[model samples]
Target: MNPSIKKLSDIAQKTSKTIIGLMSGTSLDGLDIALCEISGIGPSTKVELKNFASVPYDSAFKNRLKAITSVPNVSLQEVTLMHTYLGNYHGELILKCLRKWAVAPSEIDCIASHGQTIFHAPKQQHNQPQMPNATLQIGDGDHIAHKTSILTISDFRQKHTAAGGEGAPMAGFIDEMLFTHDTEDRIVLNIGGIANFTYLPAKSKDRPSITTDTGPGNTLIDAAVRQLFSKEFDQDGKIAKHGSVNADALAAFKSDPYFRKPLPKTTGPEFFNLHWVENKLSKAGITNVSNDDFVATLTRLTAETIAESIKSILDDKSHPPLYVSGGGFHNPVLMDWLRKLLPDITISSFENLGFNPDAKEAVVFAVLANEMLAGEGFKMESAQTENISFGKISFPN
Candidate 1:
């Protein structure tokens, strides 16, 4: 065990810590800031989301990030500049949130930042022998710590990749900690820019719980809306409801090789972007579809992929109820489709479990920061479990 991990464990167990967990998903919508009071660890862990807010990214900032993300060969200098800029930008958002909540900066113990993922290339995606699975998240902890004057833990995914797992859906670690039940099997689904889930089997001995991306979430729908309707998002699925789904287009969308891949796999906008959709449509000779119909088909793509993934993992037995979180829950069309597809199982929001559905990811990072500060590490039976202390901590000067 590293001495630092031991020191953090002692600090986490002994002190009453206030942590701010920050998350900015691939959606580029806004920064989710969750102020939480966390105590204990593993099954005994307790979390209180005392304050929460989503600071929307300005159109200019959004465009800048979109330009950097959508293009293939961005300059390294631009990426470097954005990394530091995002750290300071996030720090500013934190201070603004603290002021709105009337909390003193000194009262906050630490900040756990998920950072902004610019690119995620799993070995499966790249298949390059020497490269290994690689991912990048900007927002430097040193800049955050220096600007916020608080201990900061950032760049959490690197540790997971270093441990030989894809640096994604880190949500599984926190989901198992907070939602695992002894008597029933449960699935905690998060539909962000991408869809992913954690399967907690009814038996505690079912070592190595399952977690992986379930194909597209809102990424495709949002992209279509922007391209066809000039809207930022589908806006409660209203546009989708107005449009009908084209069966031919829907079938083509579902035929992608990704949906057929085995579990423990992951993907992102890189694979399911507007170009991917257009290419499929072009191949199917259906380029003349209506904008609304396109949106509807995109929404169905998310629901169908998600339903298939769940079936692949759970099969006939239903132990764990499905609890969902993330921005996608707000989409009525997608939710309605899921409800119809998963009628046999109980489907509810994370709020029912005492956590805000939208703020759950942010809170998880806060808990991770607490674990890092306290020097606690996770041990999992799954191949995905690295059993290593995740996140690098930077001290404020």
Candidate 2:
């Protein structure tokens, strides 16, 4: 047997494994590195988030990435080069983080990397009968494995697309495993560049789970801020808190056909981008709105859309508390709007459940890698992501 295969076999039989999970969301803010010690499998699975960090991307690097991501056209050569460059860069970042934390590469069993998503084209978005549900996430697993000298599992979304999924919001597997409660139904909401959630029915209820995108989260707000306020994000939602929402602009934004789509659908910044927002503004004939008001309206749009999605999943009598994790959780104004919109539903941070909201996505990737190595298969209440194993594994020679 190859030495790498033998090592993998040994690691699989171990009582516990240490894996470093990496996530670079569409926000392009940074790479989230989560050092996780995971044990067991399925419902018996357990994880300890030993260390976590967000290594921010510099302006030049971010610009280069933005130039290639989610656009209609791009240089193929640039895309190819970036695919390799990002993997190596992420490997170096992991090594640096390990060194900073006084750990060696040999101590880590695997690196589960959610590579940068340049484009996500589900059949719904593309309207191509010929193409299956397609999506692409760059940053090569082979490069990561070779550079980090650790077993790497990357491009997990391909497996989902191959298995007849929309290739997104893979949060259901981990969310179900980690957050499901026996007595209380839970909604594990991740408000990233594109907001999504996993509806984990109470174990006692025997209801099927549902996971879907809830439209924009911080994508529009961040893009508008960068162009207008010249900031990366609305820190604590200060701009939105002061500004008033324009009802006309809000209605125009909500008029999108995507919002009318059925549940279990997926979308990305590719659809809910700056251009989309600008077109909505033009349709609303709101040219002279204050920047703060624009931000506030966008923020309100996010809150309302998310609230509507959450409400759509619940019955009149059942109001499952929403435990939110991701960038939007930090925005007080967004949180405030959600509370106001859904007065009956309880809303709080995932921290209430003993996990770092920022680290949750990365940590979930780590859990996925663990299941791929030692578990039977990905089992979830949602059939949309069940009975499948994700991630293409790369062995370090």
Candidate 3:
């Protein structure tokens, strides 16, 4: 047997494993690297986030990625090249983080890489009867493993699409495993480039879990701030705070059929982008919207859409706690709107539950890797989903 396979077997049999998770979301802000100490499996899983960092991308690199992201057409050459480029770059970044934390490559068991999402096209978005639901994430695991001399697992979304899911919002399994409560129902909201939430009913309630994307989170706001205001992000919602929401523009933003779709649906920056916003504004016959107001309304749209989705899932009398994670949680304007809209419910950060909100997604990928290696088949209640033992693995030889 290969030494790498033997080592993997040993690691899986161990009580705990040291793993690193990498997440590069549609926002294109940076790579989130999380070093987690994970133990047990399934509902008994325990994860300790030992160290984490978000390495910001330089403007040139961001532009290069933006060139191929979320569009119908692109240079195939660039996409192929970026797969290797991003994987090696991510491995280099992880090594830097490990060095800063006084860790070594050999000490880590595996790296779970949720590579950058280039395009996500569910059947709902494409409206093609002949084509199946599809999505694509670049960054090859082989490059990452070879670069860092560590085992790697990646390209996790394909299994979902193959299993009849939209290949998105893969948080339901983890949320149900980590956040379900016996007495209190919970909603774990992750507002990445595209916002999504997992509704975990209290174990006592005997309700099935539901997970779905709730449209744009920080994608549009970040885009408007960069293109219009010449900034990377709203940065504490200062731009949005200085402006007011345009009611007409907000209504136009919400007029999309995606919002009316049933639960368990998915979307991405591919669907909710600047061009989509401009078209909606034009359809509403509204113009001359200021930059600050543009961001403000977009921010409100994120909060409103998220709130509407959460409300739709809840029974009128039961208001479960909503714990938020991801970039949208840092936006005061968005959080304030959510509070005003869901006054009866409790809203808090994932920190309240002992997890870093920003590092949550990276940690989630790490947990998934742990599951792939050590877990006994765990499945969510919705859609007859398969077990959690997925992800293609690469051995460091």
Candidate 4:
């Protein structure tokens, strides 16, 4: 037997494993590296983020990612090169974090990488003939294993898509395993470039829990900031705070058919990019909108859509505790709008529950790696529409 295979087999039989999970969300902000100590499996699974860091990307890397991500077309050469470039890039970044934390590479059992999402197209969203739901994430696992000299697991969404899912919002399984409470009905909201939520019904509730993407979280706001002010983000909603919401423009944007669809749907920048926004503004005949107001209205759109989604299914008399995570949580303007729109609900950061909102996605990938190690998967009501295990493993040797 190959030593590497023997090593992985040995680790699988152990009571726990030390794993590093990497996430490059659609926001293109940076890589989220999480060194997790995971144990057990299924609902009894336990994971601890022993160490974590958010490494922001330099302008060059961000620009390169934008060149391919969710766009209609791309330079085949850059797309091909990024697969290797990003894999090695992320692998080195993990090593840097590990060294900073004073951990040796050999001490880590495996690395789970959620490579950057270039595109996500569910059949329902794309509606192409003879094409099933499809999605793509770059950054090759072989390069990660080659660079890190450790077993690596990556490209987790393919298996979900194969099993009839949209290959997105892959949070339900891990969220229930890590955060479900017996008495508290909770909604775990992760507002990355695209916002998504996982609902955890109380122990006694007869309903099943689910996860779904709500829609543009920071993607539009970030684009607006970049296009108008030459900034990557609104910077604590400063630009938005200075301006008023454009209701006409907001209504026009909200008219998108995607919003009218029922739950369990998925979308990405592929569908919600700046062109989509500009077309809506034109359709509404709203010309001369200021940069600040553009961001403010986009921020409000994020908050309003999220609030409305939750409100549609939530009990009018009962306020479910909402635990917010991801970049949107840091935007005060977005958070404030959410509060005003859903006055009855209590919204708090995931930090209150011992997890950094920014690091949550990385932690989730870690938990998925742990599941792959255990050779098990839990049933979840999600996009995949079936119980499935994710991630393909690459051996170091």
* Candidate 1: Cα lDDT at 235: 90
lDDT of 1 by residue, 5-29 (tens): 5645555666468899999998999
Minimum summed lDDT over a 10-residue window in model 2 is located at 378-387
Candidate 4 whole-model C-alpha lDDT, 0 to 1: 0.89
The window of 10 residues in a row where model 1 has the poorest summed lDDT is 378-387
| Clashes per candidate, residues 3 or more apart or on different chains | 9, 0, 0, 0
Q: lDDT of all the models against the reference? A: 0.86, 0.92, 0.91, 0.89
lDDT of 2 by residue, 1-397 (tens): 8988899899888879999999999999999999999999989899999999999999999999999998979999999999999999999999999999999999999999999999999999999899888899999999999998999999999888887788898988888888899999988899999999999998998988888998999999999899999899999999999899998899999999999999989998889988998898898787878999999999999999999999988889988898999999999999988999999989998988878899999998999999889988875343475488889889987
For every candidate, C-alpha RMSD to the true structure in Å: 2.6, 1.7, 1.4, 1.6
TM-score of 4: 0.97
Model 4 pairs whose backbones collide: none
Worst window of 10 by summed lDDT in candidate 4: 378-387
TM-scores of all models?
Answer: 0.94, 0.97, 0.97, 0.97
Native-referenced Cα lDDT, model 2: 0.92
Model 3 stretches astray by more than 4 angstroms: 380-388
Instruction: Please give, for residues 1-397, the per-residue lDDT of candidate 4 as tens digits.
Output: 8888889899888898998989999989899998899888888888778998999999998998999999878999999999999999998998898899999999999999999999889998788969988999999999999999989999999988887778988888788878888888999999989999988998777568878888899999999999999999988899999999998899998898888889877899998889999899888889978888889999999998898888877866868889999999999989999999989889999997788888899989988988888856755444456457899999877
